[model samples]
Target: MLNIKNLQVGLEEEDKQILKGVDLNIGEGEVHAIMGPNGSGKSTMSYVLAGKGGYEVTGGTATLNEVDLLEMEPEERAAAGLFLAFQYPVEIPGVGNMTFLRTAVNAQRKARGEDDLSAGEFLKVVRAKAKALKIDADMLKRPVNVGFSGGEKKRNEILQMAMLEPKMCVLDETDSGLDVDAMKLVAEGVNALRDGKRSFLVITHYQRLLDHIKPDVVHIMADGKIIKSGGPELALEVENNGYADLLAEVA
Candidate 1:
């Protein structure tokens, strides 16, 4: 579960605020979607939770299962079971995908005082997870996200998520640059990870993605704050009416 209260963030390099007061709670096993127009601080919130730099927390707090997220390093956050899938997954030109994954997995395990997976164990598990995502062996041998299409990159991200088995997941515009089929594939990978104990916060602009991954609750964020929340029908309403009506009502 995740709890954020009046979370405020501003650009580290400038004098501008991104998240004014984002207060939201996601219970265990619940899927929540955040839909908002551009520059509404949707992605900013994700970055802040992931502990990415260049964003200073000006106010409020965020916690994961009662642990203060704002106080931890990015790697510490990951070790604490927080996974973030970026809209645009960056390429590590020379790092092999498998190498990156194994290292990360082992690092997290070490951080948690768990034993590292042997090479065989890691290979077995990763191959199984990769096959489900349709990630080929050649792709895994290549550098992370290097030469991969948009869908491939997103699928790789899901594979990372599946491998990590994080407690809370924040997907920032995972639907971006993905076609319908790619979206479904990615969504399927995400859905497979849902086990009634993991929480998800999906940030997106379109309803097509939501159609694939149904959210238990849908929130509308504007002006850096979550302005409205409802059942899955809220996404349908946004699709039908757009955020104009919601923004107007909130104003």
Candidate 2:
């Protein structure tokens, strides 16, 4: 569903490259995870794919279902069915969560030429989705991510994902700062969206999250490129040993 070829990205201002010759293909209905150490460009790839600014595409192409994602605006990418859940979800203190979600959902729908959900419809759907993520009414009534614990913020992001129902999802370290129970809840929310058609690219630093999510393919990225890829066992290997052996082999 997502195809990235020789993806090369560099900072827009500086003379430095973050992603160099990264290529990956994720078929529809598949879950793929990228595990790497800090500064390995895992998060950078996520931002680039989402059409975030400050990163210039020096080379390569990224497409969603064959649509050129690199050429589209961030909102256009979203309307085209691309969703990014940030590692640190920003808190919009003044805006209500309902307002933020409905506005976003409406914007996406409007961009897609679909009718926006009515207040009643949105309330019904969001309440259902929020409940599934274990989000309480009080939490939803508050400003987005404002005063929420780390787990709450992450869960709020998942709720956003569940509402949007994008074709491709890129989660940047959804496991970060989450406790065991919080992680499980977030995973459940993510797993609920895996319907054999929607695809996921999960970027993380550790393998424990894979235990719940169970990626179909696990990729090891180092120094801005994928060094090795294997099945779930690859993650197990990294967990048991480390990236040391793999990096040495590649060296």
Candidate 3:
């Protein structure tokens, strides 16, 4: 459902090229994992696709279901069914979690020309989704990610993903700060959202997370571009023998 061809990006301020030429195609219901060393442009690809600022798309095209994603604003992209779970979820000190979620949901609905959910209806849905993610009522009532544990913040991100129900989910280093049990909880939450029509682009550095998510394809990225593509075993190879051999082969 997502296709990118010869995509190129550079920092707007520095004019430093990040994505040399990234080509990827993710089919419906497919889960793809991107594994790369630091500075490999994995997160850059996600940020650009999500329409975040500060990056210039210097070349190529990216489309979702044949829709030109590069032309849409960030909010428009979200409304068009692109969701990004950040590596570090920011804290909004004054905005209550539930309130923020409801506003965001309604805003996206409005953008799509759908009616907003009633207060009661929204409460019920948020509660159910939060419960599934093991987020308690107290947590939901607190400010978004404010004073939350690292794992809790990550879980909150997953909760947002569940509520938004985006067609293409981009998880950038979602496993960064969790312990084994917490990681399993987050992974279970992600697995629950997988269906025959939704696609996931899981960006992680290690194979441990892959042990839970089980991607259909694994890509090794280096020097701003994807150098190799393989099955789940590729992640295993990276886990067992760092990126040295892979990088050497590409070099």
Candidate 4:
């Protein structure tokens, strides 16, 4: 479970506020989608939650299972069950995908006071999870995201999610780039990880991703605040009518 209360964040250098007293609570096993306009602070919320730099929390608190998240480093947050799939995955030239993944997994495990996975164990698990994401051996052997197609990069993100199996997954615009088939493939990979124990926060611009992920709740964000919360139908409204009317009504 994740809980945020009166959360306010701003750019560190600019000192300009982005999230203005945003509040949200996600129960276990729930998928919540955040739909908003370009400057609505949706990605800002995700970045802050993942402990990315350049943002300062000016007010309020966020917690995961009652653990204060704002105090942890990014890797500490990841070790505490936070996984963020970026809108634009960066390329790590020369770092094999498998090596990156194994290092990450072991680092988190060590952080949590668990032993590193044996080479054999690591290989077995990565292979199984990669196969599910349709990641071929060749792809795994290649440097992380280096020269990967957009779809492949996104799929690799999902594979990382699967391998980590974090309790809370925050996907920031994971649907930003993809063909119809590629989108479907990525969605299927996401759906396959859906069980009654993990929670998801899906931040997306379009309802097309929601059509596949099928969030349990949908939220409309505007002007750095969540103005309305509803069911899946809310996404359809945005899809059909756009945010102009919603913004007008809220205004």
Q: For residues 105-208, what per-residue lDDT tens digits would candidate 1 score against the true structure? A: 99999999999999999999999999999999999999999999999999999999999989999999999999988899999999999999999999999988
Kindly indicate the candidate among 3 and 4 with the higher lDDT. Answer: 3
Q: Which candidate would rank higher by TM-score, 2 or 4?
A: 2
lDDT of 3 by residue, 75-155 (tens): 999999999999999999999999999999999999999999999999999899899889999999999999999999999
TM-score of 1: 0.99
TM-scores across all candidates? 0.99, 0.99, 0.98, 0.98
Per-prediction backbone clash count: 0, 0, 0, 0
Q: CA lDDT of 175 in candidate 4? A: 94
Q: Lowest-scoring 10 consecutive residues by lDDT in candidate 2?
A: 203-212
Q: For residues 1-251, write the lDDT of model 2, one tens digit per residue.
A: 99999999999999999999999999999999999888999999999999889999999999999999999999999999999999999988899999999999999999988999999999999999999998999998999899999999999999999999999999999999999999999999999999999999999888999999989999999999999999999999999889899999999
Between candidates 1 and 4, name the one with more favorable lDDT: 1
Q: What lDDT would candidate 3 get against the real structure? A: 0.96
lDDT of each: 0.96, 0.95, 0.96, 0.95
Q: Roughly what TM-score does model 2 have, to 2 decimal places?
A: 0.99
Q: After superposition, how far is residue 159 of candidate 4 from its true place, in Å?
A: 0.3
lDDT of 1: 0.96
Model 2 spans > 4 angstroms off:
none
